[model samples]
Target: MTRACATLTLFLGLPQGTMGFASSFSACRSQASAAPRTALLRAWGRTSSGSSSERQPLRHLRRRRSEGLVASLSTKGEREGNPATEEEAQLLQHLSSPPKSQRRHQQQPQQPRTSTKRGTTRKRLTSTGGLKSLPIVTPSIELLSHASRRSKKVSQDMLIKNARNRSRKWVAERMDMLGKATSKPLRDIIRQYKHQLPILHPFEATLADLTVRAREKTGERTLQSVLDDVNDFRKVALEISKSAAREGKLGEKKSEIMQTMDAGYSRMEDHFLTNGSVLEDLTEIQKSLRSLPIVQLHLPTVVLVGAPNVGKSSIVRAVSTGTPEVNSYPFTTRGMALGHMFHPETNARYQIMDTPGVLSRPDGERNEMEALTLASMQHLPTAVIFVMDLSGHSGHLSSLDNQMQVRHELRRRFPRRPWLDVVSKADLPRLELEKAKEALPEGYLDLSTLDGTGVEELKTRLFEMYEIIERILAPPPEVQR
Candidate 1:
């Protein structure tokens, strides 16, 4: 076919020579004149089929986009040294695909292509977040124990030296010997037991009670009482030793002198233990007390109470100056933990104490840990913070059951105590929003320790509670009598 006829046939998508040659040529010339001109893209010595010419417009449109994309990609690839970036692959895909309408019209079934998500590596979530440490009471249990043991050893050493070097010395020398032997060790024992009264503030005392297992022999004899007994024994021993030395039997009754000192030591040791033997319970109490957080009773206190694994510790760690151990399983916090919240804006400091989980169990059946919770609430002038975990992740009981049981117990037992109910784990999907609301106390808060939801509101409410308490406790303005 002639070039003009061929061009006209291709443009019309018709059979060759369907029209007369002169007519075809005229049609081609008319079409060429009417068609908007485009720059001709040179073929790179590649053979072209008739369909290629038919697809020329689409190819030209894609060519411009492809060239620009590839040039940018080439520069980036040279710098990065990686081939076929995600953007390049996506752009090329769009460029290569036919129009949506055309694809829809096609009858061919497309194979479903699998695509991998980029940057989807799973993140490792820690069971607990780091938190600030509280100014805890550390009595140096190891050092104290070591010193106590060493003092006894030194006293025994002195006794042995006195026995070995029995000088028939004067009354003054013998009295000095007995006094040094008795007083030094007695003083050490007294020092070990005696604590500054101020250090054991009401909260600290309660913490000692909750954390330490003090052995009560006749009912009310405390650590202070034991130390007082030791002090009295020291005075008695000194008197006896001086009297014996003055009577001129100091050297003659060496065994008696040793026995007198031994009796005083035995008395002091017996008060700490049952059989004047190993001070097991007292030692354990000391260890526990030393580890306890030194909570100040002066600040406004808030105590958290809830079922185990109800995010109590999590909230404390997030908002306070304490970092209690947090785990998915229940009862991670076995003892009372202390923390403090300092509000910079209001300049209000609130002491936060997280008590061990209190279960919905019988009073008699309740263990020591649960008893500690009750003791703290009953004794401390605290604003109660009870967390309701609607997520049902809290151990042993359903959210509704926990709320109902805790409410019943608190109302029946501590009706007059002021408390705030907070719903924890608010970031989790809440399937029981209405149910939880109905079950929860009035003015309940939804809080998330993870995302810090409703924390500020909680702090504000706590401050408000403090202010109200302050007003109530404040002496009424002087009556104009």
Candidate 2:
């Protein structure tokens, strides 16, 4: 029996005298029948021969020994009301759990997948996606001749003029030079305009459209038509240059090469002469666009608007960093002016814009100044401060009724916008008409920029409006988290 236990321990891969080995062997001897014991001993004796064919009998013996040990443990547990011993429980746990390599794989962090394609980088979007600034557009004639000037400079090189096979080389060179010169500049200008048009803020786009319309000639051409014409001329010029150069290359004639180059130059000149007015108009439009006030859309803005000479500029000058021209006459603020104010405690910045006076008239009848004011109120994300002068002391171009009509019309057009009303030039005596008094909205703020009355309150209210706008524009909590 001692030899049998020793042999069993060696086959089971457990150390001698270990608690598990001792427990398992003793359990197997006590619980196993005589027939199984004899069979296991016979198998062990065969394994001692060290024959490869005898290894199966040894494995069978070890499996039977394990079964006997488990049966003994289970029967004893039944009597004791427990199903397994500590050693048996540990054996089962080791069998049930995953392998060490698999557990390690599960514990490791995953990495983000990388893309291998070119130019697939992500771009960040701005809060307002508006143009930050306008690109400088070169003057019409200068821009048209820029490529020619560059080509001329390149042609002036002595080595280029005196190279071997000069006529053939010059014809090919001139083909490339003239083709690129005639087309590239025009293409660049077209690309610039195309790129800028799509990203323009709505207000600026409206102004641009109005400017183009004002300069448009009847039954002649628009800016876009002129651009199309330039493109067509570019194509024609390229075709002419390539055709002439190909003919010149077949047989090198200096006179014919010069004539081919002259043809290309003449095509370019014809394009410029035909589209000169439209080109000048485009240049002027670019200048106008650049002159426009740069409004930061992310900042909470308050736009001051009303009829001519109602002291909108005065309010802007009093409450904000803007110093718009204050005058006794109408249309003092012919253009948009942007200014800023900062909260004393939070240091949050707010924008204030002074726009030109809008007249109470149909859209088609409105002048450029009126159109500009209307554009501001229509498109900007802003609070409107409609300034009214009840004293009849303004340039008198706009009566009290006209001012009220302008306010009502604007409010009707842009309902649900943050709005306020102000009676400017408060020190002067007001109109005695009861109708004007009744027409005035309740809680309208009255202030005199001359003596600073109610300016502090206006600033306070503007800051409060900014806070409300900030909450409205804030990102959701989940996104912020």
Candidate 3:
């Protein structure tokens, strides 16, 4: 019986002391007769050592079983030997802890910062002259683009797939969405422009005021009036939305709540459309404002002013960054154009303005283009470069007549301010030049834009005048031992 159990254990690849195999053998002994046991033994012995063909099948079966057991054991051993899982656990723990740099930052003292205004807010930056503050110009497209992005954000963040049909929370959510949709665009436009307008330099503010007042609308509406309308309408729409939501909650109708939301949104859109003229005007104003040159008090400005067809723009193109249209017609420049010139060595930059042609006619005859030039000359700290066409070929105004007109209004008005009288189109005719030279102040330049005559001397003279002004305006140096 012991031998039979051992043989069974050997065949199954178990130790001889294994009770499981012994029990199985005992059970087989009880169930089967002695003849069956003897038959099994005979089968085993024959299978072990017969002909080569007979032994081959049993050998292959045993090898396959041994190989499978070895493969299973090796797989288990590899799994036990691997350190990847342990390393991952350690790495995860390390990441979960706060970094040393963060901890050190937390221990450091934080300084409180104050808001700094762009340019000066006070009336005068220095005692000598009152310079207007510079305001950052915001484009209309910028405001509209911001509004679009904000609306898209609100839609994405507030999506509702399932809501309790007409519950209080759902109704509230709908109202919130409605309010956001209605108020965002309108409020954004008005609020931003309103805020920007107030803090601007007086010159800019006046310009803005003039621009806003110029547009023909249904009713007279200033920037403040537009803002008031938007604010009032917003409040009304939000209230209406809230009332609608309340009614929806009382009755179990999500449709009713949504209808109210739509109504509110429509009202908001209507409010914007009703002020459509204002928006159109504002967009036009933005273009003009963007074109308006930033006036810097510290830097010198050379303004070229003349009647139309007089080469004011040509001289500007020659001397500065401005490229004004030069042609043989009146009012060639519809608006003022600006250019920049930087002095070498000191690297100091200044502005050169090419103003729209101002006719020698009366004030009532002047247009908006002329008004813009007049405003700059009256307000901005600048020197005048009165350009005259030496050629009387255009027949609008003779060189002598043009020079006399400039001297009458501009020169008489700002006598203290430095002036540069330039006769352009020098290549045209010596006849007009000789006639114009009689009325010209000393050092008046004869310049031709096409031939590049007298442009360098003009630039040198401009810079020299700028330096002289800077020297005079510059505060006295402290007395040193």
Candidate 4:
């Protein structure tokens, strides 16, 4: 019996959890059959459960410092071999309780020494310019119970088979965020992620597949196009590998793992840089084919035009998150900024640019409006959003970067294009956007982003206008340049 127990302990490769199970079983506290318990131990990947003469070699590595993650949920930091600090012992005790989000935000400080968690709250957090905070919130034990209930509401798989996966109940309460990433087909996503899985064999790049796609998508291949994708793929692989290494969670096979990544990256890098001249022309042709449709979608862009200190940036911040710095003062946004936020449910995506403040007299500066207008034009926005300040402070609308100059430039550079107007700042009492709307005889949408009023209805109106431009301006496949 002693020899059998000793053999069973030797095969359990687990460092901490197995040792406790071994000691407990050997003590014979419960009356479960020995054969079933021994079989269970073997199923946990033990090679041999009963080799009496052989003694397993013990790990000689020193006890490492604990990673102070959600500390309250940690296990006993150290056993006889695992010596841990006093703080670690307290952390493990806290982990045994409910996680963050379970505890109220105010009570989270009393949690563990680290006291961190990701909670759900839609309150407007104070943000520094060009920055946002990432706060940790705690969760409750009732999470599992909530998930189980929701699973029943969703589907049989979600309710029954995926009971464990559905345990995250708090996620369903918020708006569906997964919809964006799920835009691609399930098969395409599976294929993309599948390529990332560690492969024992070399993954070869196919020239034929590219040829097929070139013919199918655009009926020709340009050299610049293929080279661009090749360069992009190389950059992507290197970034992915470096990020994985930086995470420091590779565990036992880290050296072997990094070596595999380095080898894979080198294989592709040598192929591209070493054999460049022969492939250059074909790549360009491929890119040209892809460019055809994109060129058609791009019309002369209409940038959100405004002066410093006049809620120009605020309208940008409110309407579309183009990252124009919003403040009570003037000239907060420095460089021309660009960002895109699509509607949650619809396929509507607005190409928005939050440009540097457009002053009447150049602040000894290059015409910021002209520069911003040119910068946005490269994107080929179907329509323009001339976001203006409506709060009784739109300084000399016709004189400042004036409407006529803007219209003349667009007509001269990109003729037969569409441009729209957006008059902002409806929240302030004295400001009347209706008067501001008259500044642009082309017409405008009256909106107040601060109050969240007129936002949705205005967006709906913008999309309707976008559809009209799409039909009128979208060029066919034959027009190359």
Give the winner by TM-score.
2
lDDT of each: 0.44, 0.53, 0.47, 0.33
Residue 436 accuracy (lDDT) in model 4:
39
C-alpha positional error of residue 398 in candidate 4 after TM-score superposition, expressed in Å:
9.2
Clashing residue pairs in candidate 2 (N, C-alpha, C atoms within 3 angstroms):
none
lDDT of 3 by residue, 88-190 (tens): 2222222232455554443221211111134323221111111122223233233323332333333212344445352445545555655565556656765
TM accuracy, model 3: 0.54
Model 4 residue 114 lDDT score: 12
The predicted structure with the larger TM-score, 2 or 3, is: 2
lDDT of 3: 0.47
> Stretches of candidate 3 above 4 Å error?
1-166, 184-192, 206-232, 252-298, 320-337, 342-347, 397-399, 432-438, 450-453, 472-481
Q: Write the per-residue lDDT of candidate 4 for residues 1-481, one digit (tens) a residue.
A: 2222211112111111111110111110112111232332232222222321222222223322232111212135412332112222232333233444553332322211111234322211111110111111111112112322332233223553433233222122110211111112222422331221111000000111222332433333322232233334333333433443332233234343334323322332232233322233332332322222111123222346554445545555555645533211111125444434455566555554555544443323434233433333322333455555545565665333354455444444333334565656666654453453444556556677777877887666656655544443333222122
125 in model 4: Cα distance from truth in Å? 43
Give candidate 4 misplaced runs (Cα > 4 Å).
Answer: 1-302, 321-333, 343-348, 359-365, 378-382, 390-415, 429-442, 468-481
* Pairwise TM-score winner, candidates 2 and 4: 2
Q: Give the top-scoring candidate (lDDT).
A: 2
